[model samples]
Target chain A: MSKVNIALDIMGGDLGPHVLLDAAKKSLEHYSDLHITLCGHSSVYQSFINTLSGDLKARITLEECDEVVSMSDKPTTALRQKKQSSMRRAIDLVEQRKADACVSSGNTGALMAMAYYVLKTLPGISRPALISWLPKAQGKKVLLLDLGASVNCDAEGLFQYAVMGSVFAKLCAGVESPKVALLNVGEEDIKGNTLVKHADQLLRDSQSVDYIGYVEGDQIFAGKADVVVTDGFTGNIALKSSEGIAKLVIDELKRLTTENFTARLLSKLALPFLKKLYQRMNPDQYNGASLIGLRGIVVKSHGNANSEASFYAIKQAYEEAKNAVPDKIKTKIESVLMEH
Target chain B: MSKVNIALDIMGGDLGPHVLLDAAKKSLEHYSDLHITLCGHSSVYQSFINTLSGDLKARITLEECDEVVSMSDKPTTALRQKKQSSMRRAIDLVEQRKADACVSSGNTGALMAMAYYVLKTLPGISRPALISWLPKAQGKKVLLLDLGASVNCDAEGLFQYAVMGSVFAKLCAGVESPKVALLNVGEEDIKGNTLVKHADQLLRDSQSVDYIGYVEGDQIFAGKADVVVTDGFTGNIALKSSEGIAKLVIDELKRLTTENFTARLLSKLALPFLKKLYQRMNPDQYNGASLIGLRGIVVKSHGNANSEASFYAIKQAYEEAKNAVPDKIKTKIESVLMEH
Candidate 1:
């Protein structure tokens, strides 16, 4: 592997620079060929730099920016006013070709706005989508996209999402030929609204990708398809609903296990197996969501992510950079658009 | 409670007459004031009638119907062709005031189409919404609506759903002033698409229900509000997605528990507590989604529902009938529309 440069937004997220620095150090240690330019306030970066050893310091660079984008700032406000903010500067590094990719744990709306403005959309792409890898049954992972980027997408936009999502799954997830499906109320073609129905027809008519018919929300984790596409609103709600239910079930299980002596004894005996299952279902393992369809690679981490979760986000950025996902999507989308 | 009559579509559902008869017998025994008119082929009902004796036989009335609505029949096709279908006949009894309510475990689209055609909508209602009880974290349940009835709802349609849903919650769920919310991608006012954003404004301006601000998908199970409303497409996907995730987790847990001797022993000891929890979260307990906004009370049961599930659906119909849900929605909607 050759050296890969990553631009890190240090001033974003709930935990601020401390969590970002910790994740950066860990990621650098794991990948000897990795280099990161930490973009944030000079004083904050300087204090952290003083503690690093010669070898670690040599691999890290500081690109100071005095401004920061707050978690509450609107995406438009951030775009118009926060040009010097660390989030914007990190994305600038990607545009300037100084970094292979940019990673941010900031306000999602602000991060997307800044990335789109700086890197711009790839040819034949209207907007970027938020794509995440979700755990499926049988130890497989399915790629789910439009996780809240464009809320009211038209049929054309959804078709673009399908094309970009297929590219991401094939290049990043290593699925040779991805089977993509549109998320709808039912598996039938006549199920959803006009937008989805039109998109379904477009997908079926085009030979850009291997398009499966409609899939319901429950089929997402059933591992029936390699890629699932939907508007940002539905995808966002579905993702959060799944998480909320998982939390509810786990809490109820814990309460039940602790309420009885027999249950407690059995839980203790089955601790190892339960622990393994819980780890597999943990949300931290799937921390980063790629902002696909951009001219450059960008990954968005959860706002409240801890150091471990932030490291996973960095790993996602590294993987996408390694695979040249943006280039793959650009080439595939052009062919798809030409066919249409 | 006075004597309440329920029209049962015995020929519908995957289990056919067997499950319907079992559930009917169980319901009659539990509610002494209840009477059921079984609508199906006379030969099938006669065979079951020979098995029933005494009070059970006295409470059930068989209304023979020659035709049946298969699960695959489209809504429009069912309405045009299956006039004497068991599902259609059961609804017809409600329209004629021979029964207070109707329950059917047949094709949802078909049932909705027939019910709308026979009973018609309330004075100010344009379309009927599907309302169901969803389990929340604090051992409470929330009323969620438009679960798949009207896929493409306008702003006015969503506002009507809020009004009808609020009435249902107040009457059936027993909430004095239901805190109604519009389901969106984000809780912020600026989030979601044009339809939801317009509906959000209309909800705030209207004094029909206790209009809470926007709520995301996670908040649905968090017990933050009494009533949550969305377009049918989103609501259906969200509901199914939660169910899917729950199934996935339980399957994984079962696999882990059975993999080793220690886990299996522990699971055996914890069986009673686990069983109770499972029963509470069981979808069968939450069957029988009410098709609100119609002039008559109509409940749609899952097609694959067994005897236990069908019993819960019948219980739901009995509750709605006792409360006179249709009259309540009609009166409430009149006042709400006047206010707007």
Candidate 2:
């Protein structure tokens, strides 16, 4: 397979250049021909290259972008002010077609704004959605749309989400026929608010995706459906809450093991198995989410993502770019809409 | 403590008389003065009374309701069409001072409609909220407000949630200070939409309850605060989704344990600890949600709640009713808002 060059926002992310530098160095091991454009503080990039003296230095190109988007800054303010931010510069590379795609562990709202402003949306799409993969208890994963992008959505907007999520599931997850479900208050067809019910009917009648019956909030991880569609507000809350609760469960288990000497000894015995089990449920292992339905590929990492996550994020961007995910989604959208 | 009397909607649940009858019989074992008004199919009550001999029959009064509200039935149609439904008759008893409170494991929307229309809201309250007690990883439970009552909420509605949740938390959880937190997309004051931000400002500035700043959705299980206030729509989705995911996790754990010999051995070894862990995390183990700030106390049990859960539901309603929780909530609301 040919190597895919990706623009890495070195100065972006919670841990900054350390994560990006590590991810960049790690990428070379898997893809010898892969070239990385390090868009960040020059000193930060050079110091990472300074650690490796061989062809690694020659393989990495440093592009200085001194200004950075702060996690606390508002998206609009960041867009107006942080013109020279590493994330902004990374999006510019994707826009210029200098790189196949871009990866950033920066401010999500700011990244979306910059991505849309730079790459724009694909044909027939009003706005792009941030589609993330949720680990199901079934050992598989489901693709969720508008994880934090669109808060206020209507029926038409939700229909678009189904199409986008279906395509993402197919191309990324390698699912032949992605089962799409509308996230509702209840499983009954007539249940939920008018918006969700309308969206459910529309998805059912559409040829764009295989519509599963109405699914409730918890069914997202049940593996009954491959793509769960909902408004950004609900999706965001579900995603965060699930993550929170999962962490809570783990913490509980940890607390239980330490409650007594017998339990602590047993916990020590179960360490490997428990670690393996928790690994399967880890969200960071899946990498960053893609800004789908955009003209160019843009992946947004969690701002608090670490080096290990950033490495997976770079691979995510490369995978999407190499798989021609945008073109596949465009084709799917066209084929389905044409029938409509 | 005085034994509390409850109007039990025997025909209102998904499983109908079997679960209700079993639960009612079980509840009577614990509370000798607990009187059960079995409003449902006369046949079901007769069979149940026949099985329970001399002493049990005297404490249980069977009223011929005959009608039932199905899970999928429309709330409005169920109320208007099924006039003789157990749900309606059960709430009617509360309205007529025949019972202290009513318990239902039926259609939630219909139950809410019945409770509001028949029993009415408390004075000075616009709409009553569905308040649920959720067990956090902290070994204690916290109160979640407006699960599905009010949808299009403004600053005032959220403030009212704070007061209702605080009062409910105090009575149910016995929190002295009852630290309240506004559930937002993020913990920052400016993180949420205009409504939440405005509500946060009001909650912080108001002298009503102990506003402990903004809380993210994930912190709910962490027991970060006593009362987590949110708009109905968001709260409903968060609560339902969390329940769903928790069930999904347990289901997955069951599947994993039953996989093979090694897993089965592991499951057996962990059974004692896992059972308690799962029990503590179970939603059914806690009291079903109560419609706080109403003219009378009304508790809604899980639609698919088992015998133990149903018994707890009645016990919860009876206990809260005995405490005159609604009056206390009204008093708290008046004292706070009137001063403001």
Candidate 3:
């Protein structure tokens, strides 16, 4: 394997530069042939670099960025004004061929806007989608897309999402002939609105992918489909609601275990199995979400990701870069569009 | 208290007539002031009623219906073709002022359609919404509406949902001046699409109810707002996705506890607390969802609801009937629309 370079937006996310820097350092320790260009304020990098030495320090390069895109900044505002922001500078590195891929734990809207502006869309792809991995039953995982990028999508957009999502699942999750399904309220043909119904028709007609009809919300984690496609609004709510339910269950379990000494004793006895279950279902294990349909690879880390989560984002970037996912999607999408 | 009559669609639901009859018997035992008119094939009821005796049999009335609405029947088909079906006959009881409320564990779309056609919308209300109780963290429950009734809603429709949901929460949940919020992808005002943005503006200006800005999916279970409103598409997905995630956690925990002797022993020790937690979060506990905005009260039980779940649905119908929810919503919606 040759050296792979990644652009890191150190100023993005809720935890800021410290967490990104810590993740970068930890990631470098794991991958010997990896290099990173840290895009942020030069002074912050200067203070951090003083404590590192040798191979770790030699593998990293700091690129100074004057502006910072805050979590609340509007996407249009960030695109127009924050040219020198860490997120934009990092994406620019990918466009300039200085970095293999870019990873950002920033405001999703702004990061998406900057990536699309800098890298442009892949051939025959109108808009990009945010695709993430969700843990499924029986040690399986499924890819869910359009988390919140394009809120209101047409049939064409959803069809395009299915094409991109199928390719991503194949490349990233190692699923061959991925069974793609549209996320809907029910599995019946006549269930959803006009948009989904039309998309369902389009997908069924397309020969570029294996198009299963429709899968409901509960079937998302049942490993019924390798790739699930939906409009941004529905997908985003499903993802967040799933997360919220997971949190609620964990909170309830914690409350139960703390309510009595006998319960505490039982929890202690069950600690090993509980720990394994929690580890398997940990959100950090599935942190990086690919910003697919772009000309270059861009992975978006969760806005509030910790060091371990950020490290997974970097690892994801490396995987996509190695697999040449952007080029693969470009070719696949062009063929799909031509077929339609 | 005067007798509150409930019309039950005995032919509806996956479990069929037996479950409905069982639930009605249990409910009559619990509520002495309750009377039920079961609409279905009278022959089935005749044989079942022979087994019952005394007060239980005396309080029940059986109404014969020749046609039955199958689960797969479309809403339009059910409305146009199945006039004498159990579901329609049950709603007709409400329409003719013979029953104070109606309960159906049938196809939701068909039930909503039949109810809308028979009972008609309340004055000044354009469309009815599907409102249900969702368990919150602090043993609290919030009312979420438009679960799948209206797939596409404009700003005005969402505003009406807020008004209807607020009154329902206040009357049913016993919360005065219920805080109403629109369900969006983010908490910020600028988060969702044009429809939600427009709805947010309309809600803020309305003096009919207490309007909070926006609540995201995670906050739904956090009990941040008394009433959460969204389009039917999003609301249905959120509700189902939450159920899916909850099932995943429970399945995983069960898998873990059964893995070995130690874990199994621990689960036995913790069984009491686990049972209580499970009981608190059971979907059956929140099985009933009210079809609001109609001139008459109609509660739709889960299509697959068991005996206990169906009993809860009956209890919910009894509560709404006792509180005169339909009358209250009619008055409230008329006044709110007048003010607007």
Candidate 4:
């Protein structure tokens, strides 16, 4: 039987390996063929293993690496110097085909740098983009691109992003046309700056991708389009700001409920429905992002991710591997580039 | 009292003569020595005048303008063809020295174009920018510039924006030695693109303006700085997105609180506090933004404004006319340019 070996940098993530260890144990019990090669500090992983249930202990492989990459460390230098780090070792497993894919909730910049320098970009791909999903109004999700991968992007970069994001929406969210929108200052085709204007013209002209015209920042939450493309700078702002706004809104509700006795009664009555809605938009639930257009499948989870988030990152890797996202992105990008 | 004659575009705004009349009534009540020339359709102004209450009946003059510029009309053509439109007529009042400034809630583009065509930019001012106060924590506000005036801008323009915003914040918000920061992807001086990078260096090197280095988007609401500088595109997104997010957050709070019994109790307790916050951040409180660096004061009121908003716009005009924002901006920009 062909097996999918998944490598995880368990020593990463803000909550240490406990959250990941718990999730990995559960994940192992759920999937018989799932093999987790946890590359991390040996002592930490061993201590975790003795505490885990028998099933989890049987399915896990502890790979030791003394070095660790801090979140704020410079990506380029860390990639070159941290050759023996758990992050690099995990990517090395993917490079050697020991693992079908890799997952990390560590430093995004470091992970992206290591993935590019080691695993390398897919054939004919100019750049890789980070893509995340959020459940919209109708229980369907929208794929938002370049969440933090490339800080500086141009017309061509956005073009590539649109195609990758569209594919992710179709394969993952089941959107057929996957109505794509290029996030901009306004909805008008000519309303934005040179980068946006050029991207609009190019997207309209492209045959492979469905290029919906410009969409504003507010429209992002409404899930106006199945796929939204933007420069990393703006995309990152839109993502974090949306999450911040959601949290702020939730906090306000809690504040109102707890303010007085009568309001607390109201809050009690409204708790169930509100909980459902909160569950719907919670960032922890939608924690994983596929680093598409790379040679191997790479999932960049939230930096502050606990075990639950990192587990979602692993599941995201599992599903993304099934879809063959890297090869798909390469094919789509190459075809578009050739035609253009 | 020194009389400051101002032009009132009675035919402007979403709600025309009614709002204008009401605003003029309130405006005259405060500044008794202030004179207003109401320029609009003869019949419209006359109808309002016939119904005018209190002493304001004698405080306003009916200057009939045969043509009126709609919100959708192109400002350049409106100025050229609508020889007697209320907007054109208002700018004409400023040019003729019949009024110190003009206030309108008409087409933003048309108003901007007409002002530039008629009043022209102040010497050493390459472009005029619109500044708005973004609500931050602690009931404090930061001056955000060129919200939608210019689509694309260079480093020099933003450098000038810093100077203009600094002077405006000091005069308006009463912030002494207001901390100014460049809005960019990262707070580091080395962050952002060439436009921001060079601007950062210039701002750092500049002795005239208070340069507080680079500030990230998330930091905008943290009340970290008194003034934030950004290009029109990003500035427009930041401003509008904040408004949209604020509305969404408030709306979600209402939705969650009214969901059930618990929510009802929560809402009952929280509504008062929430309403106070909503009121504090309401755009109506600050309805006027001086078209900084113009030869004459030009205040752009909210397009969806009502009587109360119009009254606030009038109040802003009184302040600008009193503060001489146009003259202040002129001296500030010229000094910076001369130094450059």
> What pairs collide in candidate 3?
none
DockQ of all models, two decimals each: 0.77, 0.51, 0.75, 0.34
Supply every candidate's count of residue pairs whose N, Cα or C atoms clash at under 3 angstroms.
0, 0, 0, 20
Per-residue error for A273 in candidate 4, Å, reads 7.0
RMSD of each: 1.6, 2.7, 1.7, 3.2
Better of 1 and 2 by lDDT: 1
Ranking by lDDT: 3, 1, 2, 4
lDDT per residue as tens, model 3, A258-293: 777887877787678778888888889899998989
User: After aligning candidate 2 to the native by TM-score, how far in Å is the CA of A282 from where it should be?
Assistant: 1.3
For model 1 the local lDDT of residue B188 reads 72
Worst 10 residues of 2 chain B by lDDT: B184-193
Q: For every candidate, what share of the true interface contacts is present?
A: 0.79, 0.39, 0.68, 0.21
TM match of model 3 to true structure: 0.97
lDDT of 1 by residue, A233-340 (tens): 999999998988887887777777776687787668656866887887877778999999998989999988899989999999998998889988888987887786
**Which candidate tops TM-score?**
1
Docking quality of model 2: it rates as medium
Chain A TM-score for candidate 1 is 0.95
The TM-score obtained by model 4 is: 0.90
Residue-wise C-alpha lDDT for candidate 2, range A220-286, written one tens digit per residue: 7774899888877777777777777777777777787788887777677667656766677666777
Worst 10 residues of 1 chain A by lDDT: A265-274
Model 2: DockQ vs. true structure: 0.51
Report the C-alpha displacement of residue B152, candidate 4, in angstroms: 1.5
